[model samples]
Target: ASRRDAAPTGDFHLPGWLDVPSMAVSRSTSRLRGPGPANVSTSGWTSTMHSLRVGILLGCLAFLCGTAGAGTPLLLAGSTVLYQRVLTQPGAAARATPGTAGGRLITALSRLYVYEREDLAGQAWLRVGTDAAGRNLLGWVPARDTLAWNQQLTLALTNPAGRERLILFRDWDALRSVLDAASPPAAGRALVQGIAAGGTDRRAVALEPETYVNLYERFYLLPILEIKDYSTAAGNPVRAVKVASVTLPEARGRTAPGSALADQGSAAEQLQSFKAAIVFVVDSSLSMGPYIDETRVAITHFYERIRTAGLLDKVAFGLVAFRAESANEATNEQLEYVAQVFAAPTQVLNGEDFLTRIAGLREAPVATDYFDEDPYAGVLAALEQPDWKDRFDARHIVLITDAGALDGTVNAPAGTVPVNNRAVPAVDSSTGLNAAAVQREAQRAGVALAVMHLQTPAARQAGNLARATAQYKDLARNAMTQQEAYFPIADGTRDRLRAALDTYAGDVIAQIERSTRGAATPFGPAARAPAEAPADAADDADQRARIQAIVASLGHAMQLAYLGERRQTAAPEVFEAWISDTDLADPGLRTVEVRVLMTRDQLSDLRDLVAQVIDTAQTDLDGANSTAAFYDRLASIAATFERDPEATGRRRAPELAQRDLLLDYLAGLPYKSDVLDLKKSDWTSWGLQRQADFVDRLRKKVLLYSRYYADTFGWVDIAQTDNPRNREAVYPIPLKDLP
Candidate 1:
């Protein structure tokens, strides 16, 4: 028998056993012809050999089956043991076992599963499953603080057959370490940690928690890893995974049960409903030619802008012109009979008319000439009218002029003082018509006066005329020469006028608006519009322009004051005396009290003046700023009179009083070599003296003029003295006590 042909074929077979067969019978044997008895014997021997091989193979198969059957349980037991060992002591596990012949028997396993989700304490939890090889796995552990008490989450586990089953867990942290290892710290609830098969074989894996458990009052992000598996165990490549983030909104607190006081309107709405008014008192003095023209133009521009911007509809405007005298007197005479009245009685001129008026004034004779300067008279006339209060919602007088008040009597000799028939002996003794009276009247009327001086050659020339041209130049120079000469008295007149205008305009407007709170309202937009569009539009435009010009002029005048350049042309003492005497008694002449609301620039000027005074005092012990000294003089006049009546009543009663205080303060200061060395101590005494003198003069003036000037001035006496001596001096005449 051929060794290749004789092989046993039963339940078991061996690799080198081809000669063993009961399975070697071939259909081709008949064709090969049987050998005779010897051949038959050989064949029989082959058969015998085949049978023997089969028998041996059968015995071997039985033994192998028995061995395998016995070892199967052992293998299963070993596997269980290994699993237990790995489970209990994970580090000692191995990847493969020893073979029956002597080497290791290796097996690969892979696993993949969707982690189970659980809700614990308002947070989501997930438990990940193992891969096919049961090697590496992951789980999700939710933050306990983030979860509510009762919550649930779902997870899916997948097998090699592509089948998935849902799993649920109660605690988020109970998942296996393999699953937990896969989760990041930020991941919620359940986490996954991987498992290793053998100690040597490490399988890297990630387990994704499928669902969140009880997620109340919390936000969640999308799941990160949809699928997870081990690279080496499943023969599959591992892929990167991302975890989803969660966010939640802040909670709101309950409001108090009884709170009901809430604002009904927005801040803007409240502000929008507020009402305001502005009035302009324009100077019609001849000197205000180009300026007045410019003012008108500016006003026109202002009106146009305001109308366009829609502010005109809410604001009201009024106009008053000062320094217009009666037409008859020869020197410092009134230009017209109705001198003090405002240009527009009920309303400001429409644009065209205002411009035309300005042009006419510009073309007309120069009214600010030496013979016609009487700003004081103009101010008084304006305040006297009965309809003044009702003409505009606000009242403001802006005086634009070049010189101070002139003698109202035009034909009087230049040197003679005009007699004041209206003066009361107790109040005023030395003067013709009292110029201070006009100031009192203005104060009574609650008028705020602003002065705008327009510089011109004629105006400046007039100043020289008052000093050199008059026959009583020396007398006038001596009597009136003081800070009064230096101060632009004309400018002061205009300032008084402006003050009146401001007070009247501001107060009146406030009153009107207040009074009209529920009065009949103006017509609505639909009703107010009328036919004649061009004419009406032109008229409205013109009115608005005029108002605008007035506003601008006022602003400019304020700017000039701020610059300390409010005085235009300095007038001579003679001119001021002449004007003061003549115009003081004129019905149009009146005193105006102005409370200046200082601008930044004006404040700066004041500071400079103060600094200059300090410097000057240090350099030359005599106070150089006469204007400041004058105020001091005025303040001390009362004290000097009270202490030394006989001395105060001397030739230069007011003047001597002023000079004495100034000298005393200056003499007390310690001399300094450097101009910069004028410290606060150097000026302290003088400053206090100056302040005292000013207050004293102001009080006396207010008291003396208050009665006669009641129509124009409002009086309220205020004393600012702390020393018992000073207080005693101030007490004799209280401001409010005056009639």
Candidate 2:
């Protein structure tokens, strides 16, 4: 293995396809292949099987337990302690008295169930620990209470013992094994690679469907093992518990981690197995102000784009800024910032937190302007950071700078910046390594580097400009030169800088996707949410629920229409617009989905139409427009949609045709159904529900006109030729000015 022989220098070839045999088999050794073992339940809603997923999540594929008593059911709730229950003795009253000294809530989830096992009632309840009184309690609330986890992952009752309320939870730690050469690829990414060969859907969509829910038409495979209890009526025990050969969930969705019930893999298991981290090394020296400033916009804009697309969780970002004490002057500690201080990589949650951290950060304003900077050290430090070292797959560093490094071997000109006389650490032969050494470290770390040459005019005016160019070019070719990682922005305008960064970001995503192809992370990743305030949690739940409902209703036919261009391809975008408007809580991104997919002219026309529709609907409100008025408006539009598309001919035939179907749904709305019509009552509340519904529906109709052009990573306006428009792919929604 240690022999260093001459390797082939030419590019490698793949014969049209690289086939990887599927690792899962229906054998008794590692897998569970079967119809469920049954005859032990007592309920009306009998259990059934959903084909989602399950397995070894920590060290390897978590195997299905051979025993029937697999796990304990988790407390499904909005807040764990919100509801309280009492562990009444066998002879106690039917209802325990409130505020009783012996009535402490059942708080402890650990060792929760023990008594009756063979026959047990299957129902969801909150299991809390003992209060100061030392008594255990249990509680139940309505199903809407558990909506947060419910929307993303499927939940079910456990087997015989779990039915007896003696199920297991938090088993991931006990089961975690160290990953070696033999572990199977993670289910998230592995499953994605198997579908459409991993190119049709995004890596996030393919891997963790919980976070990247909308990108793919077909959701993640929600593997349901078996249903415990199934009942049609209220107050019935669960109809049935879904069981599987392996510990899978239902067909609707997959779990992020271990909740109460049996083992639903951990978030780290569901997501990280196929994750990537990106580090940006900028020359934050005296002259780097404008570069870093503009790059901030690019980073923030890029983050918002992917976040809306539901793919932000797939990558993490780190920062590194390098500048040695101006030329030979060593007093300025500002310029002596180390590598790790440049910025360690972090997972991209919802916002550009890392970018924000660097926003107010200015370059070290030095006494004398330096034309050269030490990039090699910064690169080496980034590679060594825990973020880079810990990633199982896809590590990348994006180097952005206007200047170059000093080469000791070259007969360098006088007064060049980063003026190290062979004394700088690593660059000096006597005690330190040089740029070549840094380059080797990057390669050794398996990090692909994306270099952007931010050509500044001041740097061009330097006497050693020629030498700087030569050195910059060499540094640019540091690691993975063949991957198109270098982008030299010659014009150097703010627009050019942004474009370069966009192109740079795109390259990083593409390379990661390519490098991780046919491979799976030993474990996958699940997103982590910071602890939120009570009000904030409630608000977020409402907003997310609204979006999810629309996504859920975006039937295969609707998604197909939006994607295939065979019909109204913007139907789903239209649906989301309705969600943003009617949500009880503030939905952060309003019209991003619809706006980015529309052409510039289409966007303008849609805005005008939406404005006009709002104005027209405003006059009919006693309080607000009734559902009847909403239906009438829709009927009118459907009748003469082509005659007055947008009430103007700004739309093309294809777009107008798509708009018609949207009008049809609204026109056909049931005028007086209790659920559909809140006009007769509930006018005392905010904005009046019925009128709000009407307005939101009209907003959807306007957005549906935007003809969504399909692409590899979902849909976009195919006409956007420039990188700015393409990367600004998802813009924030405009606030409506309601009277």
Candidate 3:
């Protein structure tokens, strides 16, 4: 019978080359009597023997056919018996012959167990199977919630002879291609291909069927997938791709300093220690409503920006508003108002909230008719808090108002400009020059004073107010200016303010960087080294000798005579007397009141003498002669004061003297014209040299006089003899610090 006949009714057929037919037999039995040996001849007997052999062959063929009917059961039993023998017996004793089909099949099955271990974070397991060609197959598995971008999957194929081959799929596309290539045809031997495909969620799809295989029994490392929000220039929605190992929160943390995991903890601690005490000097007067609205918007934006930058972790802000008097009030009322401090981190002020508050401010009844809109008084009040000095490192008193200063005192006036109107009084009786004194006090306490002037018309009309406002704006905008100087506000001041703030912050960060990572060691005691010279030793001997020679020449050659040719005099007795007499018996002779004693005529005489001395010194110094123009100028100045003590008060004698000394020193230098005529760029090349020479000459003269003063007064001369230091000291002292 054909193999087709042996095949089961539902079984599918193999190709022609693989078909094997089952044997079958037909049976019939009949008894025949055999003749006695006497009846057979020798030839007949031989023929009968041949016939008997043929008959036995025919019988054997019948038995084989019969057995073919029960072939399936016999084959199953034989296979079971062989399997038992191979498993139970020792490997050496039961070894199959080389090149045998059974031996090759056993070797191929054993080789399927050999596989390399994978050490990926999200790996599941390894699967093994066989293709239609009987080739071994392998694949990788993935864990739940895992998304790997551009992942490479590999397979190891081991043959019956124990030979191994590696097959790699570069990505999902490659993996799909490999599976398609290995797929079996419908009408052929079905080879087992082991692969299982599933995922934790709908968003993820495993490219390979073996992605769910769990290599680790109870542990798995989950892969992180990133979902990005992409937008167009107009902020419209755009497409997003799920990227592997790109976490959104982690990215955000990396971009912003305080948002990082490590920084967040520290930032929280810092926030706890941060306490802000802000005094907002808002302008609530009638003229400031519109400006106040805009300011509110700006301030709201500022708050929002701070919050977005994560600065709220270390900041707390407050407010204070001020306004003018009501029309019915007899006296100008300047309201002193404040907001209760909010201690927690809050969202930026909303526009509606700001507008509502501003509107309420406009409608609110006046608290005091005598207050008026005096920003100076409000400034003083804000800065005078008892605990203010200790509470904040960044104390800002922002004054947002129109006009400069006004009197809150009552006065009789209908249409008349009140005595206090637009007048920033230099002195206050009640507060004792309190406004000016407060400015000084704020500066001393290192409290920043920022004045945002909303006096639009006045600020625009007058250059004085504009200049003052500009300075104030600078101070308000720049924290560094607050530390070093004061800046006032004016029109077009926002950019300057922002730039100053940036510069100040940059400076602070730079200082931090330097202190943390500079050549100077931090948190250590002062490093001590042996001095180059003893403390009392004469340093720079040659320079000192030269200075001494110049001083001696100056002392000997110096003369003080009126330009009108009065007898040549020693550096005037009155000047010497003035220097020697410390006690100011005459009120006019006191340093603060010296200007009161001078006459106009004496000033004119002193001016002429100063001019002559400069000319003479120039002539002598130009020839490299032992001359001292610096001393001569100093003497000329002293003589002016001696001759007419009040000359500087009557006019600007000190200014004139400074201008002459600058001009004289310039003229005395070899490159005087070059120094004076230098453009801004030329300063890069010429400034250092000119400064060096000026400093040297000025230092010699200052030292000479300083030494003289020390000797005469019996005081120690601690002044530095360097060029820069001497030039700085040569300028006449300001009136406030003169005595």
Top lDDT model: 2
1-739: candidate 3 lDDT, tens digit per residue: 0112211244333221112111111011211111000000000000101111000011111111111111111111222110000000011111122121222111100111111122244332212111111133222211111121111111111110100011111233322232233321210011111111111221112111110111011001111112233333333332222212111111111212232322333222322333333455555554555555555555555455445645443333444444433344333323323221111113214334434444444412444332234454345445544454444334556566544443222222223322232211121112222233334435334455645444344444533353334334333422112121222233424443333333323332222233223223111011211211123212234223322332222111110000001111011000000010000111111111111111123323333444444445444433422233344344334433422232233244434344553332222111112113433343234322232233233322322222212111111111111232221111111111111
Looking at candidate 3, the ten consecutive residues that score lowest on lDDT are 37-46
All models: lDDT? 0.26, 0.33, 0.26
Off by over 4 Å in 2: 1-273, 326-330, 334-342, 347-352, 367-370, 409-431, 463-465, 478-484, 510-739
- What is the model-wide C-alpha lDDT for candidate 1? 0.26
Best by TM-score: 2
User: How big is the RMSD of model 1?
Assistant: 49.7
Per-residue accuracy of model 1 over 290-317 as CA lDDT, tens digit each: 5555555555554454455454443444
Mind giving the per-residue lDDT tens digits that candidate 2 earns over 1-739? 0001111123432222112111111111221111111101111111111221222111121211121122232221222211111121111111132222243222110112111112113322222222212233232221111111111012212111000111111122111110111321232223333442424322111111112122122111121222222222222222221211111012122221232321523323322235456678887777778888887666677667656655555556667766643335464454445333434555445445766566546777563333556666566556656444444245667778777663333323443422331111112111023443334334334455656665566656665445555555444432221112345555356666675566556544443343234323221121211212122212434324322222122111111111121111111100000011100111111111111112233334444544554666554443322334444333333322211122223333223334443333223221112222333234333243334444544443332222111111222211111232222121111111100
The TM-score that candidate 2 achieves is: 0.32
Cα-lDDT of candidate 3? 0.26
Clashes of each: 130, 70, 22
lDDT of 1 at 404: 41
